[model samples]
Target: MRIALGERASGGSARDQVYLALREAIISAELEPGRRLSENELAELLGVSRTPVREALVRLRDERLVAIVPQLGTFVTLISTEGVADAAFVREALECAAIRLAAQRAGEDALAELQANLAAQDRAQAAGDAEAFDGLDEALHRSLCELSGHEIAWDLSRRANGHLDRVRRLSLPEPGYLGEMVAEHRQVVAAVAAGDPDRAEEALRHHLRMVLSGLGHIRAAHPDFFEEPAD
Candidate 1:
């Protein structure tokens, strides 16, 4: 399959370009889990040298997105259940704290921004624009974290939640899941607007728990797409 380089090569180094392209591919699931990635092939496809491709692969390996097999080749790393579970646990804890702070700190404008994001999400769902909904979902969550004034916490949450990015997109394909997610966001907004820290934390936790549960169901249904622990 021919890979399309969406943008023209800029003045940046080839390694940077390769890194950005490969990262995008992984995040969009264009590069399937466990798929082999040949250095020569990717270098040729990206019109870059093998050196840059190798560097990019090393960076991706560090991020746990790619694994190198001795004398064999490089392949996309299958996200392990244990890794996903750990990420979800950390994200839930941090986000719960974030929402609690937002309940106390979010001003009217912040609340309005969240409401606008919800409206956009509703429109995306109604129009069956899964991609747009995903973008809006991330934006809403980031906005909430920013409003809470927990910049460090937000950074940590974003990093930990990276593994779930594609999984969330998959979950959106399930029927009524998007609508339910929107409804959950509404509950969170209501709690935040009312300045009820306890309610906001509870709502946020419930939402994340549902998310983790949905991911578990997906993992069960698509064993090929997910990692299986060695016996």
Candidate 2:
């Protein structure tokens, strides 16, 4: 709830802006799970009216990132393994399919863009800039999806990836994680450059699955962030 609207607060409609801000906060764990939300306070904090805050919460509820109780009020939903699995499935299905097409259709220029992104990722990793690497990581996948001539692949994956993203963000601090990620990225890009659709799919699939590999460790370390098992 202490999230600042900050500089990315412009451009989008009030509701869209609010939705993105709240979603990012929740995914980054800045807002934390199970925290009660006050529409009035959120409106005041984001310098918006309650109408937009209400609308944004509605969107978030649809994403299962928050729950609205009849009289008790809204609260950030605890992370659920089911939610994370659903996200992973959606992202893997879309991106894996897209990478196949990207490998088949990628021209030299398109491959160059991906190479440039990988180089940037390497630089970010070397500099110990996790934030920059995160953005670059997203850009690389987006560029690959775009290369498939299906921008919606990335769009849909992004919308479905909230829970998966939280796990990913938390895994950033694992020793050698950034370097391993960059190396995996290189393998994916190399396959695409070789115009080997099968190889590209294999590499991308492995990379995507690796993101889920640390989930157990993360959940163990931050039990408060996850939902309790149902009785």
Candidate 3:
């Protein structure tokens, strides 16, 4: 599959830029699961040398977003159910713990910011702006993690989220999915606003697990995007 590479952003090393670009393409399914990758072609497309392209692929390999096969070539990895579950587990653990701390510490202004984000999510959903909703979704989660005074919760969760994100991107087109997500976010935000740590954690946990609930449906809809069962 052909992909139009976006222009390089200002700042950051070429390797980091290339890594972010390739990683985004993979997560967005622009590169696509199991698509063959050519280092030379990628380098040419990105207007960089093969060195940065190879380095970026190595990083993606570490993230399990791509695999390098000997005597064959590099190809995007098929979505792994095991990988998705692992990511969910990590995300739930970190974010649940973070939400508890956030509930205890969040001030009115912080809560208002979160509520505003939810409002933005609603507007994005109403406008049929999936990309906008996606960003607001991320912003809401990051705000919760930051409120815990440990932003690394989000960083770690995101690093482990490549496969899970593909499933999320695919699920976006499902009817009422965005509305359901906004309602769940309201529950979590309400709990946090009430300063009830236990309730907040529970609500957030439920919301996070809800993401996994759609996985089976998504895999069925895009069977070719996932890994085949082992013999």
- 38-133 in candidate 1: lDDT tens per residue? 888888888878998899889878767789999888998886767677778888888888888889998888888899999999999999888788
The TM-scores of all predictions, comma-separated, are 0.85, 0.94, 0.93
TM-score result, candidate 1: 0.85
Stretches > 4 Å off in candidate 1: 1-20, 43-55
lDDT of 2 by residue, 78-173 (tens): 988889999999999999999999999999889888888999998999999887888899889999999999999999999899888888988888
Best-performing candidate as measured by TM-score: 2
Residue pair clashes in candidate 1: none
Clashes of each: 0, 0, 0
Using TM-score as the measure, name the better of candidate 2 and candidate 3.
2
* RMSD (CA, Å), each prediction: 3.1, 1.5, 2.0
* Residue 137 miss distance in model 3 (angstroms): 0.9
- Model 3's alpha-carbon lDDT is 0.90
> Mind sharing the TM-score for model 3?
0.93
lDDT of 3 by residue, 28-114 (tens): 798999999999999888888999899999999998999999999999999999999999999999999999999999998999999
